[model samples]
Structure formats: structure tokens, C-alpha cells
Target chain A: MLGYTITQWLFGILSFLAIMFALMVVFTRNPVNSVLYLVLTFFCIAGHYLLLNAQFLAVVHIVVYAGAIMVLFLFIIMLMNLNADTEPRKHIVTRVIAGVVGGVLLFVVVGALKGAEQLQIVQGGASQIGLVKNLGKVLFSEFLFPFEIASILLLAALVGAIMIGKRDTNINLK
Target chain B: MTAFIIYKAIMCAAVFLLSLGVAAYATLWERKFAAFLQDRKGPSRAGPGGIFQPLADGVKMFMKEEIIPNVSNRSLFIIGPCLFMVTAVMTSVVIPWAKPMMVGGHMYDLQITDINIGTIYLLGVVSIGVYGIMIGGWASNNKFALLGAVRASSQMISYEIAMGIALIALIISSGGSLSLKDIIEGQDKGFANIVWQPLGFLIFFICALAETNRAPFDLPECETELVGGYHTEYSSMKLGLFLFAEYINMFISSAIMAGFYFGGYNFPFSSELYASLGLQEGDWLISLIGFGAYFTKIVLFICLFMWVRWTLPRFRYDQLMNLGWKTLLPLSLFNLALTVVVEYFRGNIHF
Candidate 1:
């Protein structure tokens, strides 16, 4: 019981930290600072995954979001080299509306979670069975078609990203 | 009982302190190694053989004035090194230092944590390590730093795909087990996985070296071009952290390489040797011996890392990109195909 409470306390603190960092990511005016905070936010999410016994997911989360995606965002921000002077200021009314919408979204999420009372909560050990090996088996066997489709989607996204990033050139259109 | 927890805590503390101490000394070693390579004696006045050089260097770094440029992003500049150190150290948790032992009617493993997805977790954590360099370079507010960060990020991304594909080949060859423990166990009985997947091992080793930003792929910190690369603006302990984190990462990657490809703590005829020694099942001493074997392997890999650093030359940026994308990627794919075919012929395909 004591162990459970300790784990819960840690989880709560981590979650709070994650949410705070995420808010900071949005609120920060500096794009570079915002991306850094987003990395922190992703770290907090990874912590949550750890708490949930999804070690693989936690690591993947860090690798993809904090490592790759955030680095790319930093690259774009640096490439543009926009400073505070170049940033457009948000009006007071717009800020207030944004705050209100953020609040409503948070409330709705919390309310929906609260309403899901009948969900069966499995303990850590029981859920540990579906670890990397089992997950791979399911991913390859049961969801092979969907997984292939997902790969195709990722390829499309990659091509799209490259196309958008390419410089405009004086060439004949197809 | 409580003593076991204390023992574990002490062990963890020892490994942490030892790694840091080693990282500090690695600077001195690098200097000496480089000097020797150039046919000159390195610093020898600090202490006997300049053994105290790292201490002197540490003090000097701490005393140095930390210059924060007015235009620099001060907060991120501060946070960057801290992030690097944290990510570097975190990957050590899942590494099994030794085998499990029976203590007080319960089994205890020598690792801090033994998650089922140990290898993937490592992959994931290493992937995030690039952010530390990116953040530092960007926060410096210098053109050189920016260029370094851009190069570092793209290089990391390009190399990561090949690294992941190499790992996929290993995973396929190993019958889809992602747990480092299982992989090590599978490689027991004097039949290491490297024998089966030599190409995969080679690919993974090269990628590992590149991932840790060691020499030959140390373009991010290349002095000739980018003037200390991403860390040009850093000073004092912040700079120390970045440098120290690199060594720490080197050590971790070496340990990981040993664990995955070198059969970890297992040795040929280990079971027979244990039997001859009259070591019964659940013997803590046997586990200790096993752990020692693993530690020795890790140390050897570290020495190899240092040797390679001294021997290799840095790769050109275009060459690095081409090697990662054109060469390593296609090779890994071919290896993956080979693994699949072998498994299929053996009637051992999991599907």
C-alpha cells in the first residue's frame, strides 16, 4: 500500500510538471525556447509512459518527439533566424479567448476521463505480458495490413515534407 | 533485507561516480594519446604521469568565467548541457551488470531496472540525445553554432534510420526478442549472435560510434571548421558537462555493444565451469563472477573506443551523409532480407 502511494505521488508530480512545461511551450514567444519546452513536455510524457509500464513506448516517445521532431523544429527556427522583434504580438482579447478555449479543452478531457468509470484497470504485472515481443507479434500478425498501410502513409508524409522543403526552381512544370 | 537495498544503492552510486571520474580522466587520456601519436610528451608536471591533470582541468573549468553573450538564449544555453548529461546517464539503468542472484529467498538482478523492452528503450533514449547538441548550438546565437547544430541534427537523423534498420536485422535474426536479457541469453553457449549476424554487428558498431559523435564522425565538434562546433560559446562547467557526457555516452554504448553482440556476461563452458566449482543453483557468488565478466567486456570495449578515436580521421559531411543513407541503409536492408530467408529455410519463422 505504501509503495502504491509513493508511485502515485511520483506520477502526479511528473504529470503536473509535464502539463506545466507543455503550457510553457505554447505560451513562450521565442520559438527556440518554445521548442525546448516542448522537448521537456515530451520528456514528461515519457515519464508517464514509464509509470504505465510502457518502457518501449516511453523510449520511442523520447526518440521520435524530443529527439528527432524537436531537432527538426529547432533547425527550421534557426534557418529562419527570426528574433523577438520579428514576432507578431497577440492582442489582449485574443489571449483571453485562447486561455478560455484552453481551459474548456482541459475541462472536457478531465470530464471524459472521469465519466469512464466501468473501464477495467489491469495491474502492471498483468499488462507487462504485452511487452515488446508480444507487441511485435500483434503488430506483425494481427495488424499486418494496417501496419503496412501506416508505413505507406509515413512514406507519403516523408515525400510531402521533402517537396514542401525544396526550393522553388525555374523548371518546366509536368 | 534492507541490506540488499543498501548494497544496490551503493553499487549504483559507485557506477555513477566511477563513470564521472573516468570521463574526467578521459580528457587527460585523450591528450596523452594524441601527444604520443604525434611523438611528443603530454603534460607531466601536474602529478606523476600527469595523473592529476583531470583534477587540475576540472578546477580550471570551474574557475573560468562563464561568458553569456547578450544576444544568446540564456535559459536554453544553461539547460542544454544538463539535458545532455541526464540523457546520457539514464540509459545505464537497464544494463544488466551481472546475472540474477537468490538473496533472502528472493531473486535480485544486478541491473537497476529490467524492462522487457530493454534494447528498444536504449534506442529511444539515444535518439533523444541529439537534442542536447541541437539546443546548445541554437542557443549560442552564433552562425557557426547554428551550422553545427543543423549538421548534427541531419547527420543524426540520417544515421538513425540505418541504425534502426541494423537493429531490425538483429531483431529478426534473434527471433524478434527486444529484451537485452533475452538476447544475451540466446547468445550463450559459446555461440554469440555476431557469428550469425556479422554484417548487422558491423553496421550497428559503426552507427553506434557515429551516434555517440566519436572521432571519424565528430563533425559536430570539428575545430577546424566550426571552431569547437556546437559548443563554441560554452564555458566552465557547462562545457565540461557536454564533454563529460560524450565520454559517459561512449562508455554506455560500449557496454551496450558488449551486451548485445558479445554474449554479455556469458562465457563458453560457463555452466560446466560452475558445475566443476560446485556452485549450487541460486549462488550469489556465481552471479558476482558473471557480473565481473560483463564488466571486463565493457572495459575492453571502452579501450577499443579510445584506440579507434586515436586512429581514425573525421569524415567529411557529404561523405558522412552518403555513407549513412546510400551505403549503410541499403546494406542493412539486404542483411534484413538475408536474416528472413535464413529463418524461413530453418522453419523457424515466428509467423
Candidate 2:
């Protein structure tokens, strides 16, 4: 049998990639670069989704987060015409403090995960129940209210985007 | 055990190399296809119907003088295309090229990885892909690039809803499994889900086109108006990477559509075909042949993408938004409702 060591190694590499990219996203000086790095970070997170047996969630994460939202972020960054010089420079002390805070947060999260050793990691591989059909049934039945609310939230966001994006002259006419 | 490890390693390398090679040649194929449609000879001089064209193009891109625009954000400019290409290539991991094979007393699926959430993983990767264009355009510090990025982002976001809704309809019909393998297996019984979910297929196809930023939906890099759109300030291999990612995306998108709706590696009368060929059940060779069939379908879809690119005109920004929100979105929602009603009446509703 192929040993679990290979899988563990693969997971280790992917997790490291994800964490590094996430850090890069914040640390990058250019906002546009930061956005790109964030996209990388999201892709790595999707990799973790694959490792977790959540294929549908992984694809949806890419579609929604990387494909759609990141585009919006990029659009905003570009529209703002931000440059390296335009970006506010943080003082060295501020940067150090931020780094320390981030390090502490990371340590806490890792420590919590380690402390939960008795917690079983469910091997929820693809089954008949996890299909889109099952998900839809749950969404439309047990979670219908929340699903509807989410739709409403999306609608509100859409309308707000339209209103905010409208030309000043058009708004004045209204 | 060492042999098995070696074989798996070789397979991984092969798939990775093959994808990159195919992505390179896809550019050549697109050019040739576009030229054929336009009634012109496409790159005939670059070695026997332009087989060496991709290599030549690669060399040219590599050798080109790299330019960093004076006012541009250098770091982001570099990051954009790298992010784009990485996301484009990463989507292939979960794709089942063939059924699992027994080698050295171990059964292994031909896919690189068999993640349960394979389809959603693809969507997530694609969503992140937009950042490449956005960041590239933003870093350029050009008004035109900024405009292009804005148009692209909004367009992608609007169309994504329609796409998601269509997929939801398919999921309801298919009984909730998001793994591509399971989705393929679900269709193995008889008719493909596309037969039952025709409207859903249509909605998904159109959205797929929009998602890939193909012709009519390719407002992000609309050359005539936005001066090459998001990549206007890009130069050298960095620009080439962005363009390369687009084509790879096209290939990947087509592969996905084929997998989800076209029955993947399963062909009509495939079982009979296997029997006629004297292939035993679970034969690795037969499965590989099935993989070839699936790939052929994917290639056809890719060709269709190029065909559409040559056929259609770019959509106006307002028209694009309208199509996404007013038309495709409503149509997909209607289709979803229809699917639910039909499935409920048929007693196919598992819940």
C-alpha cells in the first residue's frame, strides 16, 4: 500500500503554499500586487479544499472568490489608479507591531488545532449524499430561510453597486 | 512499493508536461482556426503547417525587451500574469483522465487528485483568476487599463450568478454530488444529464463563455476601444503569460463543460464497444481509450470556442451587463424552478 506519508507530505506542501501566499498578499507594497497575491492565496486555499474532500466547495470557492470578487478588487485598484508612491508607507515600528500581532494570531490558531488532538478528522470522501442534489435539498428545505436571506443580501449588494457606480450627473437628475 | 511510487511520479510529470504542451499548441490551433475561418493561411512557414509556431512565438516572447512603464507599479505588474497562469493550470488536478488502474497490486485513479469538491474547486480557482487582469490593469496606472479592468470585474461578477444558478439546477437534477467522477458516473446509466437539463446546459454554456472572457464577453481586453484593455501596459513574457492563461482557461472551461454535461469519458454504447473489443471489465486500456474520447470532446469544445471568437462581435458594456442580469440570470432561475417542479413530479427528489 502507498503509505500515508506521501499524502501528509502533499498536504504539508499545499498548506505551506497557502500560508506563504496569504502572507505575501498582506505584505506586498502595491495594492494591485497584493490583490494578485491574494488570488494566489485563494488558489492555495482551494488546494486545501481538494485535500479536504470538498470538491464542490473548492470549485465554488474559486468561482466566487477568485473569479468574481478578486476581479472586483482588481477593478477598484485599477480605477483608483494607485501607485507605489500613492500607497501610504507604514513606519518600521508599525510594521513590526503588525508582524508580531499576525505571528501571535497564527500561533494561537495552530495551538488550538494541536490541542484538539482527540477531535476526529472525518474522512468525508465523495458519497451519494454529498451530491449537488442533496446540497440543493438541504438549501431549499432545512436552510431555506438562510438561503433566501443570502439571496436578498446579494440583491442588496447588487443595487448598492449600481447606485454607487452611477455617474454623478445621473444621480443629480434622479 | 518503490516501483509504484515511481510510476505515480512519472504519471504526474507526464500530465503536467502534457498540459503545458497542449496549452502551448492551443495557441497555434486558435491562430490556425481563426485564419481558416477568416479565409487565410495561418502560419504556414513555421515548420509543416506551423507545428513549430508555438516554439517560435515562445522564443520571441522570451527574447523581447522587457519594459516597465515609468509610472507603473512594478511588483504588481509582475504578480498579475504569474497568478493568472498558476490558477489556469491548477484546475486540471481533479480531472479524471481514465478509471483507476491496478499497477503493482495497487489501484490508482488516472486523475492527479480526486477531491470530493472537484467542480466547486474549479469555480474557486477561476474566480481568483480575475485578479490577474485586475491587478495587471491597476498596476499599469493607465486610464484605459483601469476602465478595462472595471468592465471586466463587473461583467465577471454579474455573469457568475447566472453560472452558479445554472450549476445549482444541474446539481438538483444530478442528486447533489459535486465530485466530477460521481457526476460522470451518475450519467453512466443511460441518458446524460444534458438531455434532461437542456436549458440548464444552455445557461451554463453561455455563462462559461462569459467566464472565459471569450468573444462578445471579452470586454476586459477589448483592443479597439480600451487599447488592448488590461494588458495594455504589459510587455514581454509577462504579457505573453496573460494571453497564454486566457487560452488555457478556454481549454479548461471546455473540458469542464464536456465533463459535466457531455458524459465525460463515457460514450454511447461504450459498454458494447468495450465488449466487442474483447476488453474485460475494468480494463485500463479501455479506460484510457475512454479518456481519449473525453479529450476529443474537450478539443471539439475548444474549437467551438475559437469558432465563436471568430464569428461574434464584442458586446457593448451595457449590453453585456443586461445579458447577464436581465436575460441569463432570469432564464437560469426559471430553468431552476422548472427543474425542481419536474424532478418533484417524477419522484426523483431523493429528499
Candidate 3:
């Protein structure tokens, strides 16, 4: 009834659910529940990517974020044996400071978006840009340098992680 | 348009029933095969060679006492096996079962959807599959379940990397398209990807085993230690769902392996046979034969899975981790590089 197409309706529903889940992530007291909510939020965002016809990006987003990173988050939360009862309470002053920091961040984000133009949904024959072949061509030809740099950055992080992990083990063994 | 929609609805129902039926029989077959290996006859009393055994098992699972632990997270406990079964069934959507069938001047695809990113979609769904185990285990509030959940997640994650890398090499060789249809078509015209990509196939097979939580990597639900593992607290139909989902996953993975490595629905000299038999393209009989070929490959792979399950002992947890990280990861990486080099030399890919 809003004069929206099916895709547009889907977009609105996904966006609404995304924000709801994102809010739940912050509101949930249990760390595991928080992580799961965040995962739901990520899935909603990925749904938006799919609606935008970015199939590769949508699947990769779920694989990398919702699948891999959130699993690690769950692992840490589960392994640490943290529960609402075991969760340490912050002092009143500390809570106040954290709230102030979060508010400021939100304010900054809203301020930055205040002057942005409204985005138009591109409708027609499905966009080719999101398909794997075209995306690969664009990535390798135009974005090659930036992509390589990103890979190098990731390699550095990997090396740093291994070194840190090995150092402690070495000390313990010695 | 209505006809097309009706066709798709029928196709979906068929695939759903097919997966459920295969899973049911797989359980019986697993028992029969295990019996053969151990020098005993498996369940022969029910309807000749235990043909109705799966039905009996279904009834048993349905009739068992439903129990939810008092301390367990009620909602999540209910959600666990349901999620597992849902994800298990969801993966078959993109798989092309057989060649398209022509009806009333239209060629209907046997697959539910042929998305271009089919490979990654499989990986994504499989990665999400771990959540079912994780949530189920965590909701149980039992230490054993928690440990099993942790192992399942870690093991699946580790093996997934190798699996994706191994698939990358295969994709590079078998046309760069990510669609399963394209990969299968590539094989239909030429040799199956298995000839050149044996090592890649082996790596993928191993990773699939670990990902599906089959034996040798079935540490997540190993009975000796964890006493049912992630499904320890699950009872009756809930436990049945978890067990049923594993067989479904096995069937799907076997179909995928058949599609990826073996010529999916394309036996050797199939076109020659078709031409000699004077069969036209899109003929129902041809499609049926192609489907028979596909089914044979899947059955063979399932047998191999069952054979290994009965043959090999379960890997120690440390050894499983070591093999996934230290061995298969590097081996798959090597396969990727090797495929790239060979493809480049073959003039199939430009630098």
C-alpha cells in the first residue's frame, strides 16, 4: 500500500529488523546472547546486500562476519565461562563514562549523516557488477593495487598473531 | 507463469522428499554395511533385509519421551535441532539434480535456484550449520555438551578454509564461474574435473568429512568420552532430528562431491549413447538416465563415506586439529598454486 515494489518492501523489513537486532545486541546481558544477536544483525545487513544485487558481497559478508568472526566471539564467551551472574559489575562512575562515550559516538554518526543525500534504489535488469566474473575483472584491473595492499595488511596481522602466540609458549617451554 | 510456479513447487517438494527418503535409507544402509564389515547380519526381520527398519526407527523416535532439562535454556534448546535440520535441508536448493526436463514448450530447471555464487553459498550455509550444534550444546548447560560444541565449531572452521581453497583450485580449472551448473556443464563437454584435480578432490573429500562431522573427525559427538556430545541432553524426537540431519548432510555432501568431481549426471560417452539411441535432448528418459547416473555416483560416494566410517578409527582431537591446520591447509594451498600454474600453461588463463 505504500507504493513500494516487492524489493523495496523487503528492504524496509530487513532494515527494520537489522536495527532491532542491533539494539538487542547492546541490550542483552548475556555475552553469548549478545554475540548471537549481533550475528542476526549481520545477517540482516547481508540481506540488504543481496537486495542490492551484490550476491558475492552478501555471501562473503555472512561467511566472514556472521560465520567466522561471530563463532570466534562465541568461543571466547563460552570458554571464559561468563554468565550474567558471573559478569562483574561496573562502578556508577564507570557506567556514566561509558554511556557518555557511546552517546558521543552516536551523535557524531548522526551528525555526519545529516547532510548526506538520499540514496536511490537502482531498479531494472539485475546489475552485472555484483556477479563474480565482473567483480573479479574490476577487482583485478582497477582495484588491484588496493587489494594487494589489503592482503599484505592481513598477512602482517597474521604474522603478528603467530608471533604473539609462539612467544608465550616459548617462554613456558623454556 | 502459474504453470512455472507450479512446476517449481513440485520440484521443491520432490527434492525435499528425496533428501528425507535418502537419509532414512542411509541409516539402514549404514547399519547393513557396518554389519557386513563386522561379520554379522544387520536388522533383517523388518520387511525383508530391514527395508522397513527406518520406518520402525522413525516410529521409535517419535514415541520416545520428550525431555527438556530443568536448568537448560528452554527456547534455545528447542531451536537447536530445528535449526540444524533446517540448515541441513536448505543446502540442496542450488544443487542441480538432473538435466532440465521439458514440459509443454518449456524447459524447467531441476534445481531450485541457480545463483552464480553457488560454491560460496554452500560454504556459507555449512559455516552456519555449526551454529545449530553450538547453540544446542550451549543450551544444554552441560560441560560435555559445551566442550563438544566448542570442538565442532573449531573443527568446522579450520577445515572450511582448506575446503574453500581446494574448491578455488577446482573452480580455476573448471571454468571460472561459481555456478554449479557451469561446473557440471564443463565436465559434460570434456573430462571430469577429477582427472587433473585428483589432489584437490582428495583434499576436498577430507575437508568434507570433517565438515560433516563423520568418523575420523566425528569428535564432536564421540560417545566414548562426551556421551552423545552436543546432543547429550537432547532426547526423543529432538535427538532424532540431530541424527537425521547428519545423514541428510552426508547425502548432500555426496551429491556435491559427485557434482564437483565426477561428471554430474554425465556418464562417459553419454552423448554418444544418446545419439545412437536416437534420443533427443530434453527427453524424459534421457533425463531419467542422467539422474540414474547422478544417483549412482552419490550412492558410491555415500558407500565410501560409510566404509571409511566403519574402517578408520576416530582421530584424536589434537591430531584432528594438527591435520586440519598443519597438513591439509598447506596441501590445499599447494593445490591452488599448482592449478593456477597448470591453467596458465594450458593457455586457459592469461597472466
Best by lDDT: 3
Query: What total of clashing residue pairs does each candidate reach?
Result: 0, 29, 0
Candidate 3 local lDDT, B278-335, one digit each (tens): 9888888888999999999999999999999999999988999999999999999999
On a 0 to 100 scale, what is the lDDT of residue B19 in model 1?
A: 71
Q: DockQ for each candidate?
A: 0.70, 0.52, 0.84
Residue by residue across B160-243, what tens digits does model 2's lDDT show? 788888987887788667688888878777888899899999888898888778886887666767677878888899989988
Best by DockQ: 3
- Which regions of candidate 3 deviate over 4 angstroms? A96-101, A117-126
lDDT of 1 by residue, B1-351 (tens): 788778679768867886787677767887887888889899898999999999998899899998887988888888878988998998887787777778788877767766777777787878777778888888898988878877876887888888888888787777677777788878776577787789998998888888888878998777877576888888888988888898899888888888888888887788998999999867988887887788788778877777788898889988998999889999999998998898788676844
Which ranges of candidate 1 are over 4 A from the true structure?
A1-4, A90-130, A162-174, B1-8, B102-106, B281-288
For each candidate in turn, the TM-score is: 0.87, 0.80, 0.96
Better of 2 and 3 by lDDT: 3
Interface alpha-carbon RMSD, every candidate: 1.6, 2.9, 0.6
Share of the reference A-B contacts seen in candidate 3: 0.80
CAPRI-style grade of the A/B interface in model 3 = high
TM-score pick, better of 1 and 2: 1
DockQ (model 1, Cα): 0.70
